[model samples]
Target chain A: MRIGELAERAGTTTRALRYYESRGLLPARRAVNGYRTYDEDDLRLLQQIRTLRDFGFELEETRPFVDCLRAGHPAGDSCPASLDVYRRKLAELDALIGQLDAVRTQVGAQLARAELEAGAALPGGPEPRCELTHNGPTD
Target chain B: MRIGELAERAGTTTRALRYYESRGLLPARRAVNGYRTYDEDDLRLLQQIRTLRDFGFELEETRPFVDCLRAGHPAGDSCPASLDVYRRKLAELDALIGQLDAVRTQVGAQLARAELEAGAALPGGPEPRCELTHNGPTD
Candidate 1:
């Protein structure tokens, strides 16, 4: 199918697909009319790439997994590299969580001030304190 | 004080201070020797800016806050624009949280799959009936 079809099927924008190709994350064989053609493997790879990206793996970091998937899985061999990637990303995620927590505290303060001035309770009635905001994951 | 001392006091780097200035977040009354000096108010403002940035406000978004702050409480009474900025950013934060939540689900799924493979678990786990390999937020 066409780029638009591929994008819609993949649940991503066309621009993002173009970007993925440009970043060498997804390679395409150009058609005679200069349009990109994607096969079944390409579709699967795109899904995998998007999955990793949604997990907050940077584009560069997801390359290894893409390479692994593309290379044909050897029976029962551990993707140690993929595991290492996750471990490192987990550390980064922890740091990101800290940053988010800081944002949350500051935003809470801002929200409180807004609520005070508005003379009403916030509509959300206390949001979850995630990695980007709020110190209390428990809260 | 020197840029180093100012940055240390501000809990940021000299490079960041320079970047902030370049980005118009900070204004420097440059010294004859090409150094930067920040008075008490500037120091206080720096802290506020950092706090706001930590809260996910972009540098430009803080302009009205700085204006209101500089103009004092009476100024605060006059400017509704800052409130607008705050509201818009709150909306942005909500969107960001949604994006991150999607990412979190992706990570969680990846973690589960890796665990299942490593532990030699059966191909099918007891069903919560999970499958969102590329689907939108399972949440």
Candidate 2:
């Protein structure tokens, strides 16, 4: 199949296929007419690449899976190297989720505080209880 | 104050200040010697931008806060426009956190399944219960 057909069958774009090829992950042979040609095996390799990419794996991280498929493994994760990539990806996702969670907490707190302050500053609003207490007495 | 001093006081880099200036978010006046000059007010604006950036707000999103500060508000979030930005940022962060949570679940499942398969395929491993069930039916 040509690049377009392969990309279509893999549910991706030709540009993405070209990017994989450029990264040497999915090299295609040239036909006698000088057009890029791919076989069913190439389609399988591309599907593997696309699947990992959809899982948010970086292009470089997909290399091991692509190599495993090219090496005749039944599945991309059939190789130790591919399994290592999965472990690393899991860790990366965990760390990212942690960081985002922290940021989310801080942002939520800031928003709540700012909204409270804005509300308190409205013209002719009742004085906050804290202010009344602070002015009322010294012990 | 010079650009470097402004950046230092804001806990950022001169390069970043220049970038903000290029985007017209923090334009600085020129000194008589053709050097960039900023005042304490610029430091306040830069600090507001940096704080929001740390909170994961995009540069464009921080523009309203900077504008609010430049308009002589006591703080960046002292204006209705700044509060609007806060609301939008909160929504964006919530959506992103949801997406990341979904991805984390998927990646975790994939890792668990792959590890199970890998363990089952180990050399000289005991036959899985499903394999015994299939062979028993055949026999």
Candidate 3:
């Protein structure tokens, strides 16, 4: 089928298909009229790309899986390169989650501290603490 | 002090200070020569904005803290509005961490499954499993 039909069948946009073609992720066959065309195998490749994308894989990261499929593997993950991409993606996600969690903890602490200070300064609350003290012995 | 001095003290670029000014997070005074100037208080506000930004808060998100400091609060986070921003940031961080964690789990699972399949299909290993079966065995 043509680009539009393949995009429609794949639940993606023609623009995205064009971009994939530009990136050489999904190269299309040209008809005698110079129109881009795709076959069922192309649809399967597109499906694999979409699934990896939905899993938060970057467009570039999906290349290994696409190459694996084009190499005629039964599944996109059937190649060592695709498995390597999966491992790298998992590590990146883990590191990102760790950083975000640390930030969340710090933000949470700041919020709690600020709220407590605000509460203490409210009208009719306990008198604010004083830090002044005599250096020498008091009379 | 002039914009240059403020930028130097704040460890940021004049361009960033100008951007904050454009966002109205920091409004500078004009010297008699028409050059933008800032005071010690503006330095405090800028510091607050910078700290929050370093923590991944959006430029817009730093407004309440800047406003709180401008309103004569002891700290940028002293006002209720600042506390509100903190709460919102914490919630945003939590939701983001959750989503990333989910994706990480999925990617990890996919990697493990793929590796296992690759292991099972290694050359010279046990025969691949066959799904076909006869309804009855010959007596």
Candidate 4:
């Protein structure tokens, strides 16, 4: 199949396919007519790359999975290298979630403090009062 | 002080200060020597911008805080506009954290399933036992 057909069948752009080729993630063959040719295997590799990308895997991180598929594994994650990438991604996500949660807590605290201060500084806000003359109602 | 001095005191780059000026967030005054000048008030605004930025606020989001400080509020968050920005940021963070958590769960599940399949597909993986010869132990 031609590059355009492969891109259409894979639900990706020819530009993206070219970029993958540039990165050597999905190399295409040169046809006799000097056009870029791809096979169903290349489409499978592109699909794997796209799926991992949807899972937040960086383009480079998808390399191991692509390599696994190219090496004739039944699935991308069938290789130890691909499994290592998955483990690393899990760790990276955990660390990012932890950091973002901390930031959320800090921002929440700051917002609360600022709101209180703004309220207290408002015009006609609560003021300390003397109760010497109103002692009968002190209770 | 000149732009350099303000940048140094604010712990920011002159390029950043210039960019802020270009964005009209921290416009500096021109001196008789044709140099851009800033004051302590500008420094306070810059500090507010930097603090919110460290808290993951976008450069544009810091505008309200800077405006609040320029309006002579005790702090950036003393104004309704800045508080609005805070509220919006909190909501944004909440939504983002929720999405990231969902993604994390999905990636973790994928990893777990892939690992199990890979283990099962190992060359020497578990095989069905032959119990026909052990009829006496079938109970």
Candidate 5:
């Protein structure tokens, strides 16, 4: 199949296919008519790349899985290299989720504090409590 | 104060300040000697920007807070516009966190499945169970 057909079958774009080829990921052979050609095996490789990509794996990180498929493995994760990539990705995702969770907590606190202050400043609002003098005698 | 002093006071780099200036988020006035000048107000604005940025807000998202500070508000979130930005950011963060959580679940499942299969395929592994044969032969 040509680049377009391959991309269509893989549910991707020709530009993306070309990009993968440029990155030496999914190299295609030139047909006798001087057009890029791909076989069913190439389609399988493209599907593997797309699956990993849809799983939020970076293009670079998908290399090992692609290589595993090219090496005739039963599945991408059947290879140790692909399994290592999966482990690293899992760790990266865990760290990112932790950071985002921390940021969410801080931002939520800020929003709540700001809203409370804003509400307390409105007309006919409740009198503000003096925390500094909460337990001290007022002079 | 010069750009270097401003950056040092803000706990950021002069390069970052210059980049912010380029983005028109923190434009600095020029001194008589053709050097950039800043004051305490600029430091406050920079701090507001930095705090929000550290909260995972994009530089562009921090613009409303910076603008609020520049408008002489008591705090960045003191303005309605800044509050609106906060609401939008909270929504964006929530959506992102949800997506990351979904991805994390998927990646974790994939890893678990792959590890189980890998372990099952090890040499001298337990004899494979025949579910179909145990249930009787297919017609």
Candidate 6:
């Protein structure tokens, strides 16, 4: 298949496909016209690459994983190490969840503080607050 | 203050200070041969920038917040909207956390499946498990 056909089948852009080839994550045969040609197997590999990336594995991290499969999938032999990687990724997710939890608490506090201060009559002006207007500059 | 002194007071690296200036996030006045100069106010602003970043605001996001502060700390005018921005940031964080959680699930599932099947796997055979690892070159 041509690059476009493979990219479309894999639901990826041609640029990303080129990048994957450069990264050694995928291989393509060059045609007589110097265009890249891909087969059904390439489509499958590209899909897996996208799947792993979506799982948050940086391309570097994905290398050992690809190696694991290439080395004959030694079941329990390397299973424990893959388990550890999964657990580490889980811990990272937990940390991010904790950070977001803290942010939520802070937001709640800000709202409550704003309300209580707004109700009070002892100020020269209303209390200041952080508003999200303009969303800052786009450029 | 000197670069190290300013960095200490701002709780950042001298490199970061220079980077901020390069990104138009900070202003630096060159002195004599080459040293950068910063007053107490600049240090204070740097600290403020650090605080905002810690609270999940991007440098670009800080522009409006800085504008609000510079406009005489507009009592009740702008701060009210800051809560909304914070809420939006929290939402973004939540979305990211959700993605991490999903990845954790997928990785764990793949690992667990590999472990259970490792018992009967052949030495040179591909495990041919699920979608994540099955699409490699061996297939």
Which candidate ranks first by lDDT, i.e. highest? 3
Off by over 4 Å in 6: A68-85, A107-139, B1-4, B18-41, B74-78, B120-139
Task: Give each candidate's interface RMSD in Å.
Answer: 6.6, 16.0, 18.9, 20.1, 15.8, 9.3
Error of 5 at B122 (Å): 2.1
lDDT of 4: 0.78
Model 2: lDDT of residue A78: 69
Q: What is the lDDT of residue B17 in candidate 3?
A: 96
Q: Candidate 2 versus the native: TM-score?
A: 0.86
Comparing 4 and 5 on TM-score, the stronger one:
5
Model 4, range B1-139, lDDT digits (tens) per residue? 9988889887779999999889989998999989998888889898888877777788899998888877887777778888888888889878877877877777777677777777676777763322111011100
Worst 10 residues of 1 chain A by lDDT: A130-139
Among the numbered candidates, top DockQ falls to 3
Give candidate 6's chain B TM-score: 0.65
Each prediction's Cα RMSD?
7.9, 9.0, 10.2, 12.3, 8.8, 7.1
Give the per-prediction TM-score of chain B: 0.66, 0.84, 0.85, 0.85, 0.84, 0.65
Q: Residue B10 error for model 6, in Å?
A: 1.6
For model 3, residues A34-136, the per-residue Cα lDDT tens digits are 9998999999899888877777778998999999988888878889999999888878887777777777777787777777778888766764433211122
Ordered from best to worst DockQ, the candidate numbers read 3, 5, 2, 4, 6, 1
* lDDT per residue (tens digit) for residues A1-139 in model 2: 8988998998888999888888888888999998899999999888777666666777899899889888987677768898898788878877876777777676666667767777888875853432100111011
Ranking by lDDT: 3, 5, 4, 2, 1, 6
True contacts kept of each: 0.06, 0.42, 0.62, 0.52, 0.48, 0.23
Q: What's the number of clashes in each of the models?
A: 5, 0, 0, 0, 0, 8
Itemize residue pairs with steric clashes in candidate 3: none
lDDT of 3 at B2: 94
Score candidate 1 by DockQ: 0.16
Alpha-carbon shift of residue A98 in model 6 (angstroms): 3.2
lDDT of 2 at A41: 96
The best candidate in terms of TM-score: 5
> How big is the positional error of residue B100 in model 6, measured in Å on the Cα after superposition?
2.3
In order, what DockQ does each candidate have? Answer: 0.16, 0.28, 0.33, 0.27, 0.30, 0.22
Tell me the docking grade of candidate 6.
incorrect
Instruction: Write one digit per residue (lDDT tens) for candidate 6, span B9-127.
Output: 76679999888888776787788979898887677567656766776778776655554454555332145555566566667766766665666576677766766566446465655
Off by over 4 Å in 4: A126-139, B126-139
